[model samples]
Target: MLEVDGLTCRFGTKAAVDNASFSIEPGRFVGVIGRSGAGKSTLLRMINRLETPTSGRILFEGVDVTALQGRDLRRWRARSAMIFQQFNLVGRLDVLTNVLMGRLAGVPLWRSLIQHWPQNDKAVAISALEQFDMMPMAAQRADQLSGGQQQRVAIARAIVQQPDIILADEPIASLDPRNTRIVMDALLRINKHFGITVICNLHSLDLARTYCDRLIGMSAGRIVFDGAPAALTDSIARELYDLEAGEVMDDAPDFVPGELTPAFGNVAA
Candidate 1:
């Protein structure tokens, strides 16, 4: 569904993303893993057009995303949602209202200006909240929710956008272990049930292996590994992280997703 070719982003003289190239198949849950400043986030941002590439081409369903400008760029952004490490919710607004903001691309200007969402848009937002068992808290202030809940709200907001793909940049880096499990499960559910292709930048190899079907590893601003979870052997893992084999395999968390909170089955139905 998306292809990035010879992508490069330089800040002054230093390259943040140096000639990185990859492709994402439709509905694939892909994880980009790397250390700090490895260019994982920059790669996703360039694909989403949040950062302009110094030189390269990004194609979404064969559309030249790098060439998009004005309304065209706005349309592309609307179709490709971005979730951040910090839940980017308006702390003062009601949760449902924040979710409704996703419809800004499709809603008329007058309604958006007045913050008056149409009934259909309201229904969509409500349904999205329900997926995460958050319908009851629709009217609560965003700042009042827990970090996990806030992250779920952010996911709902992304869902309400009706995006085909979600680019999550370290979406769980700020959460506790329990909240990390919840957020990761929610993202997996979205990918499995809703068929939204997810490209997540994960710090934990265990989380990436548990949730992503494919793993793309980066080091020094270039792809070092790309393959299935099973293919990410000890040697490759060490190489990807620039560590010895003994130092790399001992840190993965062992969380099982046997019972999904809010019940992914019910959400799908």
Candidate 2:
């Protein structure tokens, strides 16, 4: 279990994440939903230690995550992989090599510098690519792949990290509708199939309702709601988004509970 006790981040006088607190059990698929600047990204970054917190504690299995340093911090990061909105792959590197980068923390420094990956690591990278149906593009440059394909490659890289949890920050924000379904499905599969905990920041209420087992709603850097998706009533949603009912409906016209957008095409192979 992961415990976030009164976590907070302040930039000068402004608090980006203000006294946020939550707990996540292993293998749970969670969505953090809020409007822009609500500090959803900051919360995830703080958990990953990409952003330093001003107060409170983050504990993982009885260990204080906030106090970790140097090698320990690096090891913690290795265990908790992060996926970003923009697919952050090396543009010039081959797909396989990019995935193999996940193993850098565990490998000897000289071996990684020389690109001398162990056979077992190679096999793991290949297996991750195959799982995402990107094995055929293993030798292709990351920049050459389509947005959807690149995101898939990014996910494959995360998988090869063998992370206990994945922190996805608006992962599908830039993808087309078709690719959104594909990437979201891939995340769902990773959670259910491999039992990896997934904490995702999402802008689309439809997608959050459809994919997440639990939802954490934020407004102006504060956590306002936390419950199962079904419990998130229309009125609560309006408060979370700080919008009128009509505006909420206008934003999510196709939001049928437990269903993805019907217009999305099949997953690309």
Candidate 3:
């Protein structure tokens, strides 16, 4: 569903991502693990055409994504969407309205500005929220919802778009244990039930192990490891994260997903 080849990104003189290449098949789940500045975020951004790659190719379902621009880029972006760590949403808009924004690409800007969507769009947004048990809070303002609710709203927004692929960057960085589990379960359910291809970048190796079918490890802007969870060990984690002896404890917390909490309850990223 997604293919990347010889991808590179440079900031001034420093290359943040170097010649990265990978492909994601439909219904496949892959976890991205790497040290900070390992190019994980850059890779995801390039896939969605949100960041301009300094060099290389990005193809989704056969079209060259790097060459897409204007309307082509807009359509492709809607097809391959992203979920960010920030859970970007209008704080004052109601939850349902936030989800409805997913249909922006299809709706006229004037109609969207009026918030007078067609009845079918409303139905689609409501059903998407229902998948995450978010229908009850649809009328609540985005800021009025808890953090977990907000993330669910975000996921619902993604679902409403009916994207063929979902790219999530550090999706679990802020939630508590329960909220994390809820969000992860939701993503897994979406991937399994809807067969949407998923590529997620996660900081927690244990979470990657628990939920991902394959792992892609990175360091210094290049992929160094790609395999199953059992293939990644303490030594491997150290290598991917650029850690030295005793840098990470033996009993590091396993990344079990928990329910997302309110932003006030969000732990430090």
lDDT, model 1, position 46: 90
Show where candidate 2 strays beyond 4 Å.
244-269
Best by TM-score: 1
**Number of clashing pairs, model 2?**
0
List per-prediction Cα lDDT, in the order shown: 0.87, 0.87, 0.82
Task: Choose 1 or 3, whichever is better by TM-score.
Answer: 1
**Which candidate do you rate higher for TM-score, 2 or 3?**
2
Residue pairs in candidate 2 whose N, alpha carbon or C atoms collide under 3 angstroms:
none
TM per candidate: 0.94, 0.92, 0.91
| lDDT of model 2 at position 230 | 97
Residue runs of model 1 more than 4 Å from their true location after superposition: 243-252, 262-269
lDDT of 1 by residue, 1-269 (tens): 79989999999998989998888899999999877788999998998899999999999999999999988898888889999999899999999999998898898899987888899999999999998889999999999999999999999999999999999999998898778878888888888888999999987787788889999999888888899989998678877877533433444456665345554443344
